[model samples]
Target chain A: MTQPLPMPVTLLGYGAATLTTLSFFPQAIKTVRSGDTRGISLRMYLLFTLGITAWGIYGLLTGDGPLIVANALTLVPALVVLERKVQSLRRGDDRLW
Target chain B: MTQPLPMPVTLLGYGAATLTTLSFFPQAIKTVRSGDTRGISLRMYLLFTLGITAWGIYGLLTGDGPLIVANALTLVPALVVLERKVQSLRRGDDRLW
Candidate 1:
């Protein structure tokens, strides 16, 4: 069992991870509930989801538990938002329907 | 004089960092150019900006160059988007005007 980071550092890492991962909830919920993505940028979600996937891969390769968990959790709602964004774009609806 | 990761791993880390950081550009650009945030969740940006700031500080404390650079660059556009979101909410306008 190797401790890659000091205890305090590890705590900070977890805190940072939790914050970033949990931050996605509001956007996801809003998108799912309202089905609105007008203000959301298609390119942004496209790139962000891909980036998060890469981060997850990086975590896997490095065997970092927190990174793996954080990125994985974040990916779900991100995908939800991305899916909704695409749907919104497809429908050609500007305002909430 | 410490190499924390192997060359290949370092490359992957850099790639991951580049992706996640660059992902913010589209959202920021869209918000700035369109001045629309109806679909954007204010809570999401608020929490995300704070998280990114924490991540940047964590990088600084950990002496991780890539993390520091990535988070610092990410913080700029993120703040831009966040500020616009706040402004949009304050104005109580739904459509792009």
Candidate 2:
């Protein structure tokens, strides 16, 4: 059996999770609302989404509750932002390079 | 003493770490090279930088090598992007909303 994380450590992890996950909302909202993506990097979002997916899988593999929940929650808005970014690029609204 | 993570688990963690961390480089390079911040969200970068900082501290506290290394490396490019975003906002090159 694995030992439980200390209270402080667990709290900190959750805090970190909340901050990082919530941070995506503003971008997602802005992108969805404005449909602007001039400054968003396609490669960044592409790699980020893939990485977060990996992280989600890693969390699942390890049975990490915070990691799992955080990544899953993060994926939603991240995907939204990424989708908008991709759409903008496809429309030639934004340049890829 | 803590038990070592399974080989696959450790590898997955590093893979996740690598992807997420490297993901920032494109944005950073794009921002620095082009000086464009039209679509970048001020709030997103502000909060994201803070969140990544917290994650780095969390990694240190937990003595997680992958976490520590990943976050530390990620911070550099994250900071660059954030700084450019902030500068753009300050210069009225970008809007807060």
Candidate 3:
């Protein structure tokens, strides 16, 4: 933890993290802008956020900066979707696809 | 690269991998069985799979077994959803929400 990662490795990790993290954006943006929850599954996202949290914890334990950063970014959009799903499901307006 | 990760770290890594990897199951399962991709987004999943591939490459470069394994598991279900989205989009049966 004392030393910085090699440049290439750092770049790779950050690039990977950014791509993966932002991968959730389109859906999250759509959800926020439109308020549609037809095909998204509530259980899936519940597991997803929890999984992301675990990954962030692992990253912390392992001193992997990209892992932590990526999960943190990814988690935000995912939670947005999750929150919408929770709202829809609560209203009994859930889609069963 | 030669030495194995510490046991507790390895356990934590694997546990994180397993949880995050399986998070896509419910939606993928639903997509496969019911062919309902109404809520899924093609652009979202295309980016997702690419992001996962990037992560896997990063794992390979870093010699991180848990990273590789986790992304591998996560990719399968994501691709399934992507495939369905592609199909639906191709058919012009896409849902715009």
Candidate 4:
């Protein structure tokens, strides 16, 4: 069995992992559904995508299973969001639709 | 100097920390500038806030300096976003402006 992280730590890890990873869902859905990227900042996505990559590295270095898993999973959706945002920008249509 | 994380790991950590930490800037600026929360998600914020709190705890538990610091810093802005989102919901102005 994976040794339980210290109780407090476990709570923190789970919470942190859950929030950071899932926070993008609404934006992702809305972006896709409405095809609107106006509200999203390409700069922010660029930064976020890069940051998540770093976190993934931290996870690997520390062999922190949670960090690795969380970051890895998040990278995909976050990247999608970033890519779409970029596409939206390049298209430069005021109305994303 | 902190022992360099494995070169690759260092790259990952720095990148992750930077991206995750800074990603919110665009939203924060846009949200404030436009006073629009139509695109923001309350549920996502609530979850994100709670998750960040958890990450904070994990940082403390593991004595991981980066995690602790990063999460702590991110929490304030994230909460602000959430609060604004909540307020926006309450106002239900149909026009955030």
Candidate 5:
């Protein structure tokens, strides 16, 4: 049988999950502020967002709170960047490096 | 008491983790092939790499095999891209958008 995680491990997992999820914030903010996503790769973000969504589903099914929390938070910024990327592409903005 | 994850959920988690880790492979391969990371953000990658490391640690501590496997696979490509990013920066390659 699987044992419950120790308190320290749980804490670490939560902390790590929070940091990882928050890491996407800067990019989201940059995209929002500059209204530029020319440098961001659409394919990469699309795949990543999808992957995260799958991970979130996995988390929910497993009842892994850390995974659920992290992926849920990550989805917000990922979607934002993704939308902006698509918008920029439609606008004929070729500034994406 | 916490229950062990169902087999399907575990499978889904593993599958998601594998896909996510593999997703980074393209960027790593591209960077290696082109020897250019100019468009890649250094700070962004650095933080991401660190976050992944932390997540890996959390995974190890919690005995979350899915997290461990995913992050371990992810680290290989992440470090490669990260190293290339730093190398390009030092070489004065500004192509990173």
Candidate 6:
């Protein structure tokens, strides 16, 4: 039989997932604070947002709680950044980057 | 006892992971082909690279083969794009974006 994962390993996974997921926080904060996304790449964010959505769905289907939690939290800030980026581009404030 | 994940669920997870991970390929291919990263944000890539590294470590520690495989493949192209970005910035070819 396959062995259960050790508690330490599980903890490490949780920690790593949490850290990597939360790493987007600073970027989100910056976007919110500056209201400028001139430096952000619209295509990258668009693709990433879609990718995250797919992963979230996959997680739900697979019953992978870690993936679901990570992607759900990640989507919030990513969407926020994406919305601001679109707004910035529309405003013709591209020079702020 | 907890049941083993269904084969379909596992397949979905693998497929989703592969697609999302491979989604970075076009950007990497573009950067490599054009040797232009002017439109790319250095800070974003830097943070992303670090985040991927952390995830890789987590995957290794947790024995999550999916994470390891995805991130390993991902890091290769990410690093290449990052190198090109730095080079383009240094060469003052910032207008290519």
Span of 10 residues, lowest total lDDT, candidate 5 chain B: B36-45
Candidate 2 deviation (Cα RMSD):
2.2
| Candidate 2 residue-wise lDDT, A1-97, digit = tens | 2677789987887787788889989989988988888878888999999999999999998878878888898899889989988888888888877
User: Using Cα atoms with residue i matched to residue i, what is each candidate's TM-score against the true structure?
Assistant: 0.88, 0.91, 0.83, 0.78, 0.77, 0.68
Better of 3 and 5 by TM-score: 3
Chain B: TM-scores of all predictions: 0.85, 0.86, 0.79, 0.83, 0.83, 0.87
DockQ of candidate 3 compared with the true complex? 0.59
* Per-prediction DockQ: 0.64, 0.75, 0.59, 0.59, 0.41, 0.25
lDDT of 3 by residue, B1-97 (tens): 3466789877876776777788799889877877768767666888889888888988887777877888888899998899888888788887544
Off by over 4 Å in 4: A1-5, A57-64, A94-97, B1-4, B94-97
| Candidate 5: regions farther than 4 A off | A1-4, A33-39, A95-97, B1-8, B33-39, B95-97
Q: Encode model 5's per-residue lDDT on A8-47: one tens digit a residue.
A: 8777766766666886787687678767565566766777
Kindly list the per-residue Cα lDDT of model 3 for residues A1-97, writing each as its tens digit.
3466678876876777777788899888887776768678777888889888888988887787877888888899999999998888788887644
Candidate 5 is scored at a TM of 0.77
Full-model lDDT, candidate 6: 0.72
List per-prediction Cα lDDT, in the order shown: 0.81, 0.85, 0.80, 0.72, 0.75, 0.72
Indicate which candidate wins on lDDT. Answer: 2
- Evaluation by DockQ, superior candidate among 5 and 6: 5
User: What's the best-to-worst order under lDDT?
Assistant: 2, 1, 3, 5, 6, 4
- On the 0 to 100 scale, the lDDT of residue B94 in model 1 is 55
Off by over 4 Å in 2: A1-6, B1-6
Output the better candidate (1/6) by TM-score. 1
For model 2, how does the per-residue alpha-carbon lDDT over B1-97 read when each residue is reduced to its tens digit?
2677799987987788788889989989988998988778778887888888888888888787777788788889888988898888888888877
Sort every candidate by DockQ, greatest first: 2, 1, 3, 4, 5, 6
Which residue pairs of candidate 5 clash? A38-A96, A38-A97, A39-A96, A39-A97, B38-B95, B38-B96, B38-B97, B39-B96, B39-B97
Docking class of 1: medium
Q: lDDT by residue for model 4 over B16-89, one digit each (tens)?
A: 67678877766677666666666566666777778878877777778788878887888877877777777777
Per-residue lDDT over B19-73 for candidate 5, one digit per residue giving the tens place of the 0 to 100 score: 6778778667766876745445566677778888988998787677877888888
| Residue pairs of candidate 3 with colliding backbone atoms | A39-B39
lDDT (Cα, tens digit) per residue for candidate 4, span A49-79: 7777777768777878877888788888778
